[model samples]
Target: MSALPRPARTAGRIFAWTVAGLLLLAVVIAVWVGVRGALAYQHLQRIQTGAAQSTAALAADPSSAAPTLARLAADASEAHQLTSDPVWALASHTPWIGPQLAAFGTVAAASDELLRESLLPLATAAQNVSIDGLRPVGGRLDTSVLAGLVTPAQDAATRAADAAVAVQDIDRTPLIGVVGTAVDRADDLFSSVSTAVDTLSRTSRLLPDMLGRNGPRTYLVLVQNNAEWRSLGGIAGAAVVLRADDGRLSLIGALSSGDLPRGFTNPVVALPDEVTKIYDTKPARYFQNLTQIPDFTVDAPIAREMYRLKTGTDVDGVLAIDPVVLSYLLQTTGPVALPSGDALSADNAIPLLLNEVYLRYAKPADQDAFFAGAAGAVFQALADGRGSASGLISALTRAGEEHRLLAWSAHADEQAIIDGTVVAGQLPVTDAHTARFGVFLNDGTGSKMSYYIDPDVSLAWGSCRPGGQSAPRQLTLQLTLTSRAPADAATTLPEYITGGGVYGTAPGAAEVVGNIYLPQGFELVSATATNGAGFAGGVHEGRRVLTFGIDLTPGASTGVTVTVRANTAAGDAQAVVTPTADAARAPVVVATCGAG
Candidate 1:
């Protein structure tokens, strides 16, 4: 057959034309989307560059970043408009690459929202308030400056929070390649912005009152000594009453633990049954032991009650800071002169206040006086606004991050606002997205030997199984305690440093009670101590608690590794460890199951 029938030929021609037309249309649509996406990507890159520059500029001069903020908003709006085109939106529903398109558009929209609603408004609000304005003047802060920023900060925080939620709601599982990476990066950026702004907002709302805008406010400042570790850092070695009236701050009174009652016949506050069972009534009875429970809400009340009993004054709030915090502040203050004729700087503040004070002074009274002098000098520097305001802020920020700066407001309303903040000094709280573990340390040796401790905490998430109420993920927390004490520390170290053979610990040895608090929903698989060491286990506040008594002689090291199965699915893992004399190290995270 040389030729086909006419009908068959006509049908074949029709089919060929239809296929050609469809192919051409597909090509046109692809080209259109590609061009738009390329332009959007260019705008996004510009935004990123502009944002980085704006951040630096804002830090240097908050008012001058308005131009950059405006440009960023413009770029973000253009990118959002391009990605939101009807054709681009329609193509985003397709398979495979559809998720990529959707993610790109989501990022653009979120960026636009943040720039316009949060950043721009914040820039405007910050125009009148510079870092210099925050510096103290005659031991007083101009609360009005921050008062003006409250409304704008609140608005920006709300917008930022909403934007963060929108960005985080994007499901990254289906994304791949560069799109996945971009989405993840965007998620992180938005989340950080939200958190930072939220803190600012809360601070703006709370600080004015806390500084005594409404009335006179008096807060008890607990200067903890990290040399003898407690659950919340260390014992309250010293205390000061800080008075604030209409934004003016002054140290009204100061005392050391030696000045307070040694122990109470009864607890100033009722101890929870679990707390009593696990930690006994020491946390409530002794002023130094108030922080032994690792909860400032409880620790603060007892501290206030003790102060009231010692002197008939009730504080409005309690703020705690350790030697590490003092060290951080010293970085900004340059150096403060102590009563001992030595200058305390950031480099030597930790050592001098924590270690040398004990060794140099044989009597507790002398040590207390030395500590009080150091505290007063540092406080005077801060009150005089002796350093760069930004540097001071940075120091405080670092201290807060290290859990060395803690606050507890007696007011219910203010306490509610501080509940989830880093400064609240509460135990680690876990959620569906983040599982938190706590490594609280308490010294059983009753000595300042904790200054020689070197702590290394590591957390890892193993494989995950998909079942149950949620995915069950395996996790491990490894804590290593190394003693840096000299070989002849028993004789070389002061009697106070070695506990004088008290607390049942051998001289020149450190007995640390390591309390490992597991995640609330996690089940303990095993808690293994290196070298077959013994441990005590219990349940506290709906979480499994493992207590390891680590006795490290001179140059000795001990470790505890705890493995558990987390029933709740979480993408992030956090370990809150007690602040030590040594610089805080970040928790080591090895996540095989995608838990950070």
Candidate 2:
């Protein structure tokens, strides 16, 4: 081409250079966003890992939890800063991946808050607690050391509750798929933490008084004999007066049920009308009959009152523990040597106390003496600090979770903390919102056959409709009982353990009163035994209850199936069983209905 104008050529060159510069800028921005997103994701992964490790470590060794928690707090704070960076915020407005980035940012912020405001403070406070001082030296605890922990422990508990509320309010649903399994895990961790915090808060408020902050507090400790089963757990065959003065626990007195007077006319607390209708009103006639009422809330107060009438000393609270709980304690204390040259270890405690005692001591008097000795030995070991505090705490936690250890306080304020806990041992009130069931067993044979009884529970739901439709959903609960006695149980077992015609049942036969407590919204459709027998159904505490009698011989088995229909939608269902001498491995089946 000919030589064009110089001005036009200059303008074309400038426009070309401007286009190249703009492309370069776009590439630089894209690289920056990508790198920042990757870093944020990496930080999130670290936070998840650290949180899990910290939780496990804390549970494993609560005495040394502060270090792991502090590290976790630092990591979480860094993640929060990284996710909240300006780069991430700008990327959050970008197309397609914007929602993911925003969800991650929310999770990061919540995690940071939980670690810094809740876990760190609680762990730091825990570090200051001296569990060793709670131990008794020469049968006396230094109350001053325990008293010192009250303030820090209470402060930590308050912070934990606040953190729990914060975590509960955060919305983590949007972060589920974006963060893979970490989001679900975090949700579960937070839920468990919330529950723990709530418990800690309650414990903090009650611990001071329970440890005798006001004055000396006396508790009636009922050693439930699971071998002779009752509605709540077992018959209260042996009891001890436990006095706590500023956290120093001492066994004041011990007595067997036979030693208590019978048929006390005076009532400490009036029995609930429902209790009178279901169980007899005369719960104080015999010490063993105190737990005839299925609910321990009813049983515990009655037991306390009965103790007062007999001992003439008012108890501030009542605590019930079965042999299973004792075994758990033995695990922490290693073993206890009784005065009779017999040693009770964790492995042998349950069997020795539950079964072998019946065999070794044919007379009830000898059995009582053995139990008293064993109890004293274990208590003395605990007082002497032979057990690890962490182990003891874990053991008690497990027992409480299984409902083997129960407590009820006479004080209204103290009892309020225990009212809704599993250890409170109360039946559920009428509520359409939740599903609850109970499988309770009472020894109709009036013998020690319960030691050989094995129970299995299976639950399943059918035709469940969501969204509160009045659909009739079926819930089936089948309980199978097997007698684990030896083939020659009739001859090998003691006469007293083999029924002995105590409750008008056949000799060598195990008779059980099986009660199935249904939910509030459920109606009993049918209840049948394995032998085609029918069950008697009634209403107690606004819930349908089915009662049946089961009799099994040695090496025999029987089962009862209870079916109920309800208008409620299906959700998570739970069954509370009467704790036995050993924990039962019950199979749980969950079935949900409705189209996706």
Candidate 3:
């Protein structure tokens, strides 16, 4: 109340200042402790999240799941080992950025809600982009606020980022060093994932260049039944995409049912480690030495693979996307334009055809909220397939219903020569395998397509073995199809298949015609297609080709001879027709008469 003496006042001032300093010191200590805790927590969270994500991103089969875990583990080891050495002020050099980021759960959760509200479209679009055989990109990893934490971490991220490089030296096990270089460069762990993506984007195509047959025509293709494919034929460069609550997508890294890259014998790393700690626990434990599904050069341009081994081999196209993405895409555009010059409207085709995105921008309508639950089911299916097949089947069915427009032809039954039917086995051939589909068309008419299958193709212990190995055996086939439906030959014949197979048109594909690679040197020797009332066989080279004649007419018969030229009279004029009679019923039909 009354004025105090200067000496007394000074004493009080000292006491107050001292208390203030003590409190400030305590706050600083609290923040430091908090940040470090966060870092540890972050590492753990990442491990947990990563594992769950890996599981969610794959098929239930071990063949599908194992490689995913290994790749993710490897990638994580690399991420953890990456070190950043930004030039920061000595006074400001903080080591707790990683730790503070550990606390991102606080602000990030709130920001996520806001982000999510604005991200519905982004999430939807992200799904479609992935389905269309492209990677899902552009979103905060529920990590934006974590980035904010970094800004306040007093150069903590900078130091930790740099240290991360040093940590990478040990990252390599008997076979290591993925992130060591990244860390050694003092790279920021915080930005490593994003940076890697940027790096790959600029340096080269994720997969090989979109080369032609020179490179395997690696287009993206998704499978409804991974097991069936493996049992039948296997695959190459196969990857699957899944969605997150935050509107971002995490790739379930996997190799194709085909071959692993050179020096990568163990595609699926089973050991778990500190790096694996950044993902979901069990799944992380399951896949500790992985990061991403490698983008293989399933398909490439002729020029790109000109000098590479096995030139003139390529994937037809990529088939990617899960049921959720399919549902969303089908729900959005209503129908899509396929390379076949048709409009696809069925939702089922969404799963099969999402890979061939020629030239187009993303439209917001591609996402469907209904797909979320089913998508999660798919993730669960991958993680706990043995525990939950019903759930997976439901997810597959629901999603298929959402976009089941394209009914890809399947070789259901062939009484004479069983070729592709998994049920009608021929020494356990693969169910199906392909990267991208090489779409070919002739307007309203059929097309001349060369479907590139995996090179290491073969069948297993099935009686109808067609010359294969324990490994897959692939072959290149060139097919030529002509249109029927005289009305503009440009209106219906190829229209239905193109529309359904490539564009997602309703009622699915009218017919998908192509020759299964026989390596038998068979040529279109003759044709009865021209004799069909109101139809004519198409032409190619300088000869009138017939195989791709008017598609099968209901209750009618059409035949085209493929001359095998006796391979020498000793070879027994022996020949095997691809896509036997039953194959005619496939979503992509290539057969003679009353087939599918």
The best-first sequence of candidates by TM-score reads 1, 2, 3
What lDDT is reached at residue 35 by model 1? Answer: 94
TM-score of each: 0.93, 0.81, 0.23
Q: Could you give candidate 2's per-residue lDDT for residues 45-152 as a string of tens digits?
A: 776667656654454454577776787777778777877877678877876566567656666777776677776776666665665555567665655544444565
Model 1, span 201-296: residue lDDT tens: 888789889999999999999999989989888999887788889888888888999998789999888988888877899988998898999788
Count of clashing residue pairs in every prediction = 0, 0, 139
Top candidate by lDDT: 1
lDDT measured at residue 39 in model 2 versus the true structure, 0 to 100: 71
Poorest 10 consecutive residues by lDDT, candidate 1: 587-596
Candidate 1 residue pairs in clash (backbone atoms < 3 Å): none
Candidate 1's error at 245, in angstroms? 1.0
Q: Give stretches of model 2 more than 4 Å off.
A: 1-63, 77-110, 142-184, 262-269, 428-434, 463-475, 523-526, 563-570, 583-596
Rank by lDDT, descending? 1, 2, 3
Task: Give the local distance difference test score of model 1.
Answer: 0.82
